[model samples]
Target: MKKRVLDVGNCGPDHSSIKRFLAKHFDCEVLQADGADDALAALRGGHIDLVLVNRKLDMDYSDGVEVIRQIKAAADVAHAPTMLITNYDEHHEAAMKIGALRGFGKLDLAKPATVEQLQPILGSAD
Candidate 1:
């Protein structure tokens, strides 16, 4: 079965770009959620192998950290590995404190280098 990655964000095309990129290279399905409620709902409804969170949410850009925390706290979905994606490099450290394996700043992700950077992290399902 293909692994599923839950992506929590609504940053317009950037969100779609990441989703498409992950689907193409990670050998996984990238599900999307625009806010905490939607994310939590998706989390409960599916078998997710990974969780990618944007540093800022559509509801409140600064809520991404808190959202990840909530995702980690949920008993049903907490086991999936999680990470934060933010333009601010600083959130990488913060994401770790909240239970993410690692974080990717949006700045780094925007570059073509992201494919190489994420290969090890996402670990191809193949």
Candidate 2:
């Protein structure tokens, strides 16, 4: 079965880009959640291999760190790995402190390193 990735809080364009990237490189399905509540609901409803949250939610401008905290705190979905999408070191560090794995910046989406980072979580396309 294909792995499922729940992408939270990214804008329309970013979501599209991430969906395409994951589909092409990881062979995974990308699910969308515009906010924490939707994200949590999706997690509870099904199995998600990974959760990717933007640094700042475009819909509400909420901190993605708080969303990551909630996911980690939730008993049902805590097992799923999480990654914060951001270019800022401080923000990435903050997400890691809250139990998120190392994630890549949008600017680095096409980088080989990004593919390497995701391979462990999502596996190779082939």
Candidate 3:
């Protein structure tokens, strides 16, 4: 069966790029969530295996860190790997503290190097 991934980000160019990249590399289904609430709902619904959360989401309800915390607190997805994607360096430490598996700067993700960096993580998750 194909692996499943929840990609929480604004529906835009950046999110499209990341979703396309993952779809190309693995037999996976990508589900888009506009913000923290939607992401948490998706996780609780067992629709995804991992979560790729954008640092900035559409809603003002909460940020990615809080989303990660919610996921970690939930029994269903507590062990799910949460990866935070951002353009800022300052959020990295905070994301890790909230239970994110890793942080990928959008700058790095824009480069071809992103594939190399993501390979091992995706492979293991699969």
TM-score of 1: 0.82
Clashes of 3: 0
Can you give the TM-score per candidate against the true fold? Answer: 0.82, 0.97, 0.81
Please provide, for model 3 over 34-126, each residue's C-alpha lDDT reduced to its tens digit, 9 standing for 90 to 100: 876788788878757678888877555357777777778887777888888876767877888878776677667556566666665566322
The local distance difference test score of model 2 is 0.92
**Candidate 1 root-mean-square deviation in Å:** 2.5
Q: Taking the tens digit of each residue's C-alpha lDDT, what string does model 1 give over 1-126?
A: 567888887577877787777777777777888877888898888777777888878656666888888888888878778888876767878878878877666566545566666666567522
Model 2 agreement with the true structure over 9-122: per-residue lDDT tens digits: 999999999998888787788999998999999999998999999999999899999999999999888888999999998999999998899888999988888888888889
lDDT leaderboard ranking: 2, 1, 3
What are the clashing pairs of model 1?
A: 56-61, 86-106
TM-score top scorer: 2
Using alpha carbons, what is the TM-score of model 2? 0.97
lDDT of 1: 0.76
Worst 10 residues of 3 by lDDT: 117-126
